[model samples]
Target chain A: MDVLTDEALDLAPCGYFEFTDDGNLVRCNTTLLEQLGFASEELTGRNVETLFTLANRIFYQTHFFPLLKLHGRAEEIFVTLRAKDGSDLPVLINAVRRPAESGFVNVCVAIPVRQRRKYEDEILQAKKVAQKALEENNELITAKEQLEAHRYILDHKLALFKQRNQDLIQLNRVITHDLQEPLRKIMLFVDKLRLDEGIRLSASGEQVIERITKASRLLKDLISGLREFVTFDVTENPPSSVDLNQVVAKARDLVIRETGFGAVDLKMSELPVIEGFGEQLQLLFYHLLSNSVKFRRTDLPTVRVEIRSSIVQDNQFRILKDRYHYVDFVRLVYTDEGQGFDTRYTPGLFQIRKKLDARTEGLGFGLAYCKKIVENHNGSISTESEPGKGTRFIILLPFRQSDQAFI
Target chain B: MNVEMDIIRRSNVKVWGSGSRTLLFAHGFGCDQNMWRFVTPAFENHFRIVTFDYVGCGKSDLTAYHPDRYANLNGYVQDVLEICRTLDLKNVIFVGHSVSSMIGLLASIKEPDRFERLILIGPSPCYINEPPDYVGGFERKDIEELLETMERNYIGWANFLAPVVMNRPDSPHLAEELTESFCSTDPYIAGRFARATFLSDNRRDLPFSRKPTLVMQCSEDLIAPLTVGDYLHRNLPNSRLVVLRATGHCPHLSAPDETIQVMTEYLGTPSLN
Candidate 1:
């Protein structure tokens, strides 16, 4: 039952090829030649990559060769060969490397797997779609996890803020009631000593009494200022559309009546109506006007204060763009011709205890009150000043505040 | 695991031989460090030989494969440099094959004083042709089809090898044993590696590397043609191009004698330093 070896190889059912170690084709079976529709001369002397499709050429170099070199054999390798007419012939190839007289030779046998390739292509297409869906699902899960983490952080911060707010209210009550009672008694006793023992007291004793009265009065004013500062945050006043012209007029009259300085030259431009607490805005303006009058130099005969306002886009402010979502903001510039402090003190100027000058009458709560008021309205305030020069305050307030703006 | 041990396990690093000078061999995209078996023996007596499988290939710890980190050749470069740093290898001779040639070049550029010289085999700076200036012997469509072929073959091997792998759960080395007959990899990871290898463009990085380089190009390489070799020679500032008589992409595997002969001749020349 032994057949001729050459006849058996040439007449095999599957395609066969043998190439040198360099991949130059030496011989191929008749079945392979007929499968590719090529003459022996077309493929015999050419590189084996020429018989493969462009993709299969890359596969041959990157995978097929390396496998053969490493393991001496490669099995069940899927590739596509190109026929002479430029059609792909999908094949399953098994190859082995052997030592030859010259160097090495690679022998491969390929079976046309057109039917199995068609089924595999369908499965691959389905798998790609499934993989894409899985990737999208994974991305969604990641995004949801990030959102949950952010929510947890925000909730924790809100709880801390509420606790602090409760503590502030408790402190405000103690300052208003317990501290003020003893201070009132001190003022009454000091008055009684000045009236009842006036003739018996020596001149130096009268001078000491005058100091006591002045110190007691200053203490009273400080307690009042501290009360205003702490109590303003406790009140939950809804925001309303308040006209700035009326607010500034009322604040100016209060400052003039309190300080008894009638030589103020106030100039104001048309102001915009904004959403804010009316009383707080009035207090904000009062602090600004009083600060100018109290800090006025004796050399200057008249205090000149100018108020200018304009609408600006959010982009005009580099720092506040990310803080607020408003489309437009009302920018107010308040300049006063008074004795300005050194510009170096501008950073801590708005702090409650940062008194720049010792000669000022009241506690240094004027600028602090102004900052708190502006911030409560979801606005920002900055000041520029130089010694002996005038001071300018720039306040930016949104035209309409969102509900979340109220802390 | 500690940092040094983690890297060693993750990359499946192997070190052998005994000498003062070191030789680090980085394999290309398709296979692992085992591909260098035929060539490493020749240099064992004179050089401290080093080899490693990139993450996601061979017996490397597959759990360390992160798609975001391994999305490009830079990730593979990090694998090589980490191995060198862990071993405290200095003044190394880097021998890279295929895509790894560019990866080694980039690593040398990043750490300029680490490598003494670079020996690149069957290297291509870019695989796609930019017509009117360069011919890299591949088209964009050709790469796409290559990916398709890889997917098909990967699915075929996964189906065939699943039963063998599952049945030998007690044998930790059984998977490696089964995959020894071919360059087996995770299908998903292999797709990404193929994309990174074929779509990379390192043509601009050639002039920056000042290390002495030896470019060993095969005569009839389908991946890296003669034109690509000439281009590399012209672009690399301090390099010598030697066209090997051997053919195919892996000349060391196809003709180890010729590959080692040229390397020995080049290393013997004292002027390269």
Candidate 2:
């Protein structure tokens, strides 16, 4: 029989050991003893757990021993051993369990793996770093996708708004040109008929002609108001600095001349010049003053009007912070002592043809035109009123309009 | 498939044996239900034996694995209770190994009427030492190092063993043999399981369960030391502690005769079941 000699076993290149089923070391080669810096007597009867570091001891029980018991062998199991001097020595182990006369004999061979372990650890660390970067990249991609979805929705909504605006412009052209031409011929022929046939006409015929002239004039006023509201496109006019004092003064003269309400007292304060459409700002104040004179109380001989202006921080209005990037806004307050309507109708007051009182004169497009003009200048207008009290209009306009504000 | 069949297929549940009373064997973290082969045969004659693999282990459906759900021990506890409910199992005798011991205890606490008794082998409520009061036989750093070691070994196996298995296509049996030797597990799922098992602390849950429990501990278990066993015995109500003469963590695999004898003796004694 050819058998390995004792001398050859002792001088083997790798370490070897044999233990019983209960893990008490029965024998170990000299090479293993030299590797662990232990004498034969020190390791002979000790349990095999003493040979491993604390972490590898867990690995041995949980993985190595279970695998050996189930499959009768374990290969290429990585473990770290604790030498006598308390330094760690990494090794790759292969073990097998075989039955002997007394019990099972477990044999193991370990190869010292210093350089291989170092390289493997470095590779593992690099892999971990790469995995982390990949996760972050995935999160960034998700955020970008969400932003793109929002932009797509906004673009779709803007296109719908543009289409609706085009439809309204077509309807306004038909009302101002086609409808007004026939109505103008009726007024001219009615005037001619009244002048040429005055002697032959009865009292009832003259009364009917008078009513026809009044109704046609009211219809004409409504069509022109509708046209002015619809055609005030802010994009056609570039913004420039305009003084609020000058706009208010010009608006007051036009309102008094148009209404013939000479008993009017107007008060004002120093106002700031802000960047906005100049013609739209003047038209906005004209509609506001005209609304107050039209709703004046007949019992009071004179109408009182006051205008105040100041600069306020943008955050003062909670609704403006999300939409505007401006720091400061110019606040203009217009108050008048006139008979006011029910405040419940304030929400729909800015809508065209929304009238508070059917008995009152003129169309209900005054407040609506005021709202459109204010908004075209990248500003806002809201009103507060109570029956039998007075009316107040508050306006907020940005000192410098943002380029993206129109859309 | 129906929901009942789905549950059975999801966990790869296997039912056998001739007796009426059921014995459900739950495997530990690293391996699957096949670990109970040596131990299950002994009880097959007198008791009905039930075994299953947790999702992502053995032949269980891998698609059922959700990372957020299985991030902690509660997910595994849910799996156990769901299996019990789906099978309509009542008064079950649950036998668990390693981390599964705590899992069984938690399930019994959640539904006390479904469980009759528990036999915990090599159970450690906590793996890392709390210091000053408790010694669980390991520190946090040691557990981390164990994870690193596991990664090294898994990567090493993929690089070293894949080529050898592929080159031997002439013998298909050789490939099957190699696969059987190394329990097939996805490396990523195995890493997650290791984290959930070793980082868990179930010491607070010990006092809540009052079932008849048998704590079978090995004499020199490196995973769950003698102190941990004594700790369990003191805290677990209506419990008994028996230290086996066997060594290492898994006595059921190494010394099945002794394991079966102790379990049979404990069952034979008249108490609750």
Candidate 3:
């Protein structure tokens, strides 16, 4: 056999060692001894398996040894050696079984692979991070699909709600239009009977006819009021800038003419010009003022109107936070010395024809019409009342609202 | 939408020949149904021949190739059984190449009545050597190196490897055609199939097949060496091992005449050509 020189063997790039069949280390090179931080004497008699970590020791016995025995060599196998300082030395090992009389001696070479192992670990960690990101991306896709499905359902329901609302309005128009004909005929016949047959009728019979005629005229007024209320197509009307002070002045003129001027004291505050339908705004003021004067307390029959403006943060209850761009609102408050009802009636106040006081001779559509007008202007109306106390109506109108109305 | 039709479309099954008895030929790892082109022509006059591509290879439906479903060999065996059930074929002579050999054995073991015989060409029960008793002829490192080789020369590997693996380097045109076919396969599917083929160990499953199996081995095959053929013959109960004088892994491509001769003799059919 050709012999390798001592310098050639010692200066090699890798560590070399020879072990018996039982894994006892017989001899090791200077590079291996240096890598292990050990003296040659300390490692010579030790079991080579003891130099490895517990797991690597088992791997060496089970996989590495069997491979070497079967193929006469094992290449590029991974193992970790226990160093003198209790740290681990990761390496790639190649071993060859040598021929012997009784058994075989194994010659093994190990190359330090700490840098390679670190790169491999980084690759594995990068793989794990990539997998996590993929899973999260899948979850996000699923969530987006669910949101799309919910939006579809909401859009369908909104369409149905709009259809139902249109149908109800159409039905009201038909009923009101049809009721006017019979009312006109009844009034005409009663007038004819009083004019053409007055002498033949008894006085009690004539009095009964007069009462019937009066009730029919009242019914005709109520039907016309409801028809006018439903006919306001606020959604279709384009808005123009109107001064609330002018609107209030117009409403006050109507109230004075109806109540014989100077019947109730009406106070007005400085009001700003806002974008709204002029006719609706005028009718809104007319309804509130009429209610105040009609239900005024006998002792103190005055109504005060105050107007103010401020910014308001959006909330879920009254308005949708995302639907509007304008945050500023104008508040018009009306406080009157009227016979107020219980606060429990506040919810029913805005409902159509819901009267609070039975003694007050009203069709009870005034406040409800006021609420509809306020809503058309992209505003809200609310009331605060206490039994035996006065009533205060607060109307909140957006300062510079654009026409992105939601139904 | 019919399930049987779906299986037929997924496998790209092609049926030909006149005889009532069916010869279902399943292709192996690297190539597709085109690998049986030279050998099937001889059987066309005698038997009803069936040929198909594995999912993800050749013209089979690429969308139907799910990694989790094709992760193990049993999944492929299920495909073979589905083909049998869908076609309603009886007394089938299942001829499998390379990895498909073991795949066919597994199918016959699960449903013995569906198959009449199993013909395994260049088959290995285990690719890794397990010391004193067995020699599969390739070390684990060699297999790893083979995978790396595939990675490095994947573009030209089909052309380059076919000639070498078939031991016909002189016939470069044959390999060029193979290269075109290999390029047709989806790269991701090919990689997955490669990993499954090399890393699997089916040594313990050899004894489970009750069907009479024929092990055809080549003399100088690198992938499945001679000792593996002997191992298969010994483990299988009613089996025979034939050592062909051909020099490479693919006898059907390299020496088609000899392959046809042996198959016809085994089936007790006189030579027609």
Candidate 4:
């Protein structure tokens, strides 16, 4: 019987690990250990879902393991891992059935997708910016002027050109901003062709306008995304000791010019500053607040932002400070009596990519972006909602230890 | 939004007069304070004249008509008092045309101070038919048909009807070829005026008025029949009933010379002794 030596397994490029069907880590190679940033002794027999956030556990239970059990395999499944210190590590895990004496299905391979994700995400962000700018500019240029038949035809042509320009601009800016080392790959080739060194490919013919347009658009997107990302990122955390009443007023003023809110009632308790990102915390608070304002709930146009802040011990601090500090964080248990969404989407509350509410012409990125911002700040976001009773997001984080935490 | 405009009987009833007596000429429906242009001028050097439209019927702001409020005859009467009260007019030789004549009676009943003498030209008290007892000019069904005609073609009140009522080529005041003659009080006020003139019952209002009324009954009065004038005189206390030697409801327009003569005798000398 031939078997891979431990040395041979250590040299393999992909991460290899074996766990029981119950998600207990049984064994792993050095490559897997290093990929996971752990030694063999530290990882064995640990429940795998514990390493994943609750959402990833659900993903594995729903899709990853079911496929493995049925086809004795699953391929290229993307999931985020909880880092050793509780940060998200996005990865693509593939698994194949292996012979086992026990009821274990297969060994799994995890490929870290950090670089690819950044590239795709940056491209997406750049494309979105260019598209948004084009739309806004077009709208401003043609306010209520739909009577002209020629203008409609021109708008159609411009849309296509705008799309092409988006690609070129995104590629150009992705290379220029140098957010990551590898984003340069997409732009450098386009730049070289612009220098007249290469023969004009059919697609490259429009590269004159297309490439420059694409580059300019990419730069524009990156700048805006960076600004927004920075802005949104700072606001992702759950408010620990936030004066939500003040926050409500602040947020309402922001959207007052956009919508009409005749009245808003806020029922809130004083908040404590827990271990959270403040700006992001305020933003998460503001996003939910503005969302309530934007929808108008035409049936009941008056929006009531009720915050249910409780004095529960901060679980994040309890879990986190078990080893590091003596701080006890505050658990901000707030509810939004807002435009409720379908109950089926409750599963996606903490997911970075789920958007269920399409009630408004929203970016569908508010909640998802809110989740990302929250997670980036080391806070956990969750929600329980029904169709009509309205939606409530529950955020738990280590708060600043003080009576002044809440106002 | 219904309002009662105090008609100021233009203190002089004339800004500048070279006259022995004041010539007060009140306008009929669908006109403003400006309808005394032709007749008042003939009396300008001779006497002082006064005229004005009821609230909704003219250049007055249409925002003044409160529908649920002013839905009767006394409201118009009160409007008349208010005009006198505001103008502080006295010894007014009140000359009212058609509905305005009864409006003058209604006002005189409440306040006899404004009118020295009332000249009712083509006045009708009850507009609807009343089981042989009432001498109303039109039947209830006929009045309803007029209302339906108004409501059905509401804009026509503004276009064709408003122009004709104001100053059309076929009507009086072709001399005043004004353009704003077209843009007028709201169509709503016009409808309310229609209801005020044709729908209200002022039969009992005549006896309450004790002023010496001069009834100028017209032969071809579509709105106010000559018999209606007789009915008013039968009910009124000291009214002098006179069958005007003219045709249509508006004697001041169709037979101005005859109307001026009758108005001159009653208001000019009061009692020429």
Candidate 5:
């Protein structure tokens, strides 16, 4: 039971190695042999340097042997040992010369690098990545601060821009607004002069004054039209469900009945109750139908209004879970036989004051305001038209309030 | 300080788009939010595009531009982050042009959770120096000369032209009409703005970004050289540098249709699924 059993020592954690005086391996434990990729019996009498690379062997012969001989001890020397497969094993080895007994030489042990060192390397790499990101974040925050400051400055510039444009239009209206009182006062004075017996005027003078008054009245009408177009309810508006049939009937009564157009063929369909501004949609239809009535053959004019559902829409019903909420759409189509212009004029169709033809007398804000009203209802409108032929207008919108809320 | 007020200020941001993914666009020094207008309409139905200007450059309030705080580009980047936080924008695709491109990098590095990807249109981290073995293609002296030309020529033209060009009858924010007019803009502020845009260092922010990124480098870009794109590729762990077919510093303006084609394609392609 007390005998020296190499099997027991071979099973230890550390590798045990023994060498003769001439540097040949006398014996090695299972751990050391296994680390060198060899069996313990195979390394029993091999050269100790055979476990090292040739370069390592040269260092072992020149420096390691002398140091071992001088002090008969060396501890924790970092080195690589050649395995049986010719792969290098990183190790920290302790070598010491044993007292020579029956031609024995030295002993050595290799302890694999402590687990703490490998753990430190991994943590350091991760830390470097985190630190880099932190630095970048800091820099980004600083840049954002500067951009915010720029945005502040730009906001005022834009406000001034809005204010200045409004001021220009405001001036025109203000001038026209005050001019009305002065113009009325002048009219009263001219009437007084005509009624007074104390003053006598030529027929030419009377005609001239009448002409001036007529010109003034016409100027006021033009300014009123411009003002109506300029002042739009753009800022605050809410979406509500409205009936299309009611709006279309009202449009026909006002545009066709008042204009005295020949028996208006009105085809009303069961339009869906859509979520939008009811008045805005009514105004849009009123403008389209009125424009059709306005620009017709004077002697015998016929107006037909067709309302139908549109399958073509700007958006499709999409179901999104992770990225966004779902979206739903309902479409409506309006086709009229009213005269439309060339495709080239389509770009200018919605612009206020851009009169497409010289034949029309009214200001060109009719179609322009229609565009604005449709937009206010969270809906879209575009027209397909030809010069001699009629126009087909399409509108896309959300059918329900809940669906519009997702947007 | 005025956080609630700031929210109301950006109320004009687009409300009628139906796209799935949202891209927050930050323009460069001299321009406003409209710089992205050329490409915004192209992706309106597919991708929700968010565009806004730095305080002094666009429709943003000019009084917010503090010269002392905004003496560099880093201050402008903070505004971008503010826009993201205020709107509760997450997993966004940040599309930045010129100086804003680098600004986006700096922001993404700090708040990776907010930005899913970065598309740097024309970015240069370092503006003045021509680092060793690198071609920055401009000297500090050259920029000074350009600044002198802006003062001597550009300002007068801006002031005179703004009134007529911006007189659209239906335009709500009418001052934009003056943007191109003779230098109606203050000379001192414009000059300082130029200096802030042209000088900045953002190389430190490159390695820290963990989000996937795409650098859409314009070929023959006189402003940001190709070497800067390569530098970003080497530093960012997962990054791709794509050289676009077009040339010029502002692809969004000079080549809008092609520029929108490339951006819409990238914005439409989903990273997941």
Candidate 6:
């Protein structure tokens, strides 16, 4: 019995074709014609390349043909065949070359692999999605590390500031206490000379004693003022909510006690409560009120302290942060009809040891101390003054102190 | 380091025939050294013959198929040169078919002392039409269609050879062994060689040929038409053109008697004259 029959070749389970070496289709099995949805006569003598998609056709020409020409057989190559309606069929191909009378003949067969190809595409898509998710996770981790590094640097800077402030406070306490002991001794000796030996002393000597006494008293006042300024480090005091109205009443009482309330007229308005260093805020109010009393024109002195509350963005000011878009704040406007100085001295007016009037017997640190206190509370203090008309002081205080609000 | 061994290993070089002078044969893109089996026998008694597969074709090592090296015609020329150098061949009569004809021309130009003459059968310098000046027979789309046909045939062969059991069929006159020897190729490597062959433009290389050449143009070749043969003949300084009354690209396959007669007439004359 013959192993291969003509019937078996034509009716094989897979698609089969035979073409000349130049690629003209000479014969095709019924199975191949039916698979491609074509009649037997429709395909004969046509180029076998028409059975594949364009890209697959190019692959066949460049790779498949050259291989078949050299080796006489090609096996199990992945390819896509086009059906009659233009849909694609994934298939694997195998071919053998045979020499004919004129040229060469190529016998080929195609097996469908559409189901396996679909499974492969799904695996590729899943791998791509997982890769994208991994990349996003890496980005998030990098961002978190950057934020942590930034916080660490800020913490280091804040620590250094605290240590420096502590050192300055300690030095100031020593200087004030040690210097005051000698100043008290000088006052005691000057008083002894005026009281016990007054009958025997000459008139010129008496005049010298008077001058010495006056100079010693002024030195005492300046030294005490310097002590007040050096001790005003806000870092030493814990923050708390304090009423500005209460702070104002206390400052007014201190000012009136020093320079009797006989000539000057002082008026106060209702003020809002704010979060700050209580002791430092009280000192800020005291220094500002005293400046108004001391600088009064003496003929018709007028002083009014007006306080108001509102919400404001920190950016409105030159110094405070606008990081937190808006914050609760208290504004104190202190106006006085006093002997205001020249505007030329305004910039230095709030600097330590800046005296506008040398004749007045007062330390120059009052305004500087007030400015420092306002700053410690995360607020601002500024003054507007005319030479002989009056002076108005404006103070803005934020309700909160933490720098975190800015970011 | 061993250049001779490398070429022998890569190209599967085979030497046959017996004579003082050597004749080297290079196969074209589609088939290997077997294409010359019908023609080489006629000259075996008169001249020594050398045949070899191209880099990625026939029994040559497929591992040596580097796409970059084989992307241009120069790489194939290198294979021919290596075979000549390895065998210590001089005054070689080089016979090339289709794309291998360009490969032989380039080799001769590089090592002129080695080759006495070149016989280019069905050779085309360019396969696509350049419109105003040249028409190498096939259009770009036509070659594309031709390639498509080649692929489908390959796919069909692949399916037939797969594990499915089938009854073996036989044809008259064609023995089982002889029939099995036809069109055996590695599909992956063949596609690359096909692209390198058809898409190549060797028109500029024609003018530089110094060796006496024989351009064997087939009468009705769809691959290399008559016009390409004329172009090569006009450009080559020392060359002769002969149109064979055979049909198709491989005249050696279809019309071996005519291919042998024309090649013998050209090579029989002395070069020193």
True contacts kept of 6: 0.04
lDDT by residue (tens digit), candidate 1, B176-240:
55444345468889899999899988887787677899999998887899999999999998899
DockQ of each candidate's interface versus the true one? Answer: 0.21, 0.17, 0.01, 0.00, 0.02, 0.02
Model 5 Cα lDDT, one tens digit per residue, A1-407: 01126667877888777775455577677777677788666665566777866434433532344334333455555455778998866566678766565633678888765463366446655755875798689769967986797689779888998998889677766856776677778777877877789888899988877887777676667667776666665534566667777877787777766677656676655776777777777777788888777765344456666776522212222232112222334455677676667888887788887787766767678888888876665566787788657777777666655444334
Among incorrect, acceptable, medium and high, the docking class of model 6 is incorrect
Report the lDDT tens digits of candidate 2 across residue range B102-215: 989988876666899999999999989998999899898999888877878886665322322322222344444444424436777777888889998888778767689999
Ranking by TM-score: 1, 2, 6, 3, 5, 4
lDDT of 4: 0.57
Provide the TM-score for each candidate, comma-separated.
0.60, 0.58, 0.40, 0.36, 0.38, 0.44
Instruction: Name the better of 1 and 2 by lDDT.
Output: 1
Tens digit of per-residue lDDT, candidate 3, span B167-262: 123333454344333312565566667667766677766765667888999875656778788888998888989998764566786577899998
What proportion of true contacts does candidate 2 retain? Answer: 0.43
Where in model 2 is the C-alpha error above 4 Å?
A1-5, A135-407, B159-181, B271-273
Cα miss at A393, model 1 (Å)? 46
Worst 10 residues of 6 chain A by lDDT: A315-324
> Which regions of candidate 6 deviate over 4 angstroms?
A1-407, B1-6, B61-71, B128-195, B217-227, B237-248, B251-258, B261-273
Better of 2 and 4 by TM-score: 2
Give Cα-based local distance difference scores for all models: 0.83, 0.81, 0.71, 0.57, 0.64, 0.73
State the TM-score of candidate 3 restricted to chain B: 0.87
| Tens-digit lDDT track of model 3 for A1-407 | 11224877866888888776555576688788789898877775676766776445434532355344334455666677888887888877787777655566778999988897777666656755886698689768966986797699779989998998898688686657767878888999888888885457789989999999989977988887777777765745567788888998898888878876455556655677888888888889888888877777777645544443322322212432212222445666677767787888887889877887767777888888888988877688888877657788777776665655532
- Report the C-alpha lDDT of model 5 over B60-132, residue by residue, as the tens digit: 6666665654566555666777788887888888888877887787777545568888887877777666567
- For model 1, how does the per-residue alpha-carbon lDDT over A41-60 read when each residue is reduced to its tens digit? 77746888888998788888
Alpha-carbon deviation at A296 in model 5, angstroms: 82
In model 5, which regions exceed 4 Å deviation? A1-407, B8-16, B154-161, B166-184
Model number with the top lDDT: 1
iRMSD (Å) of candidate 2? 15.4
For model 3, the superposed segments whose C-alpha errors exceed 4 Å read A1-407, B155-180, B269-273
Tens digit per residue, CA lDDT, model 6, A1-407: 11224888888888888877656788888787788898766775677777887556645653566555544567877777888888887777788877677667888998888786676456545754875687578657965876797689768878997998798777777668877888889889878888995456789999999999888888888777777667656565457789888887787888888878644455665577888877778878788778877777767645544443333323223432211133445556677777887788889889998988877756788888888988777678877788887787777788777654333
The per-prediction tally of clashing pairs is 0, 0, 0, 41, 51, 30
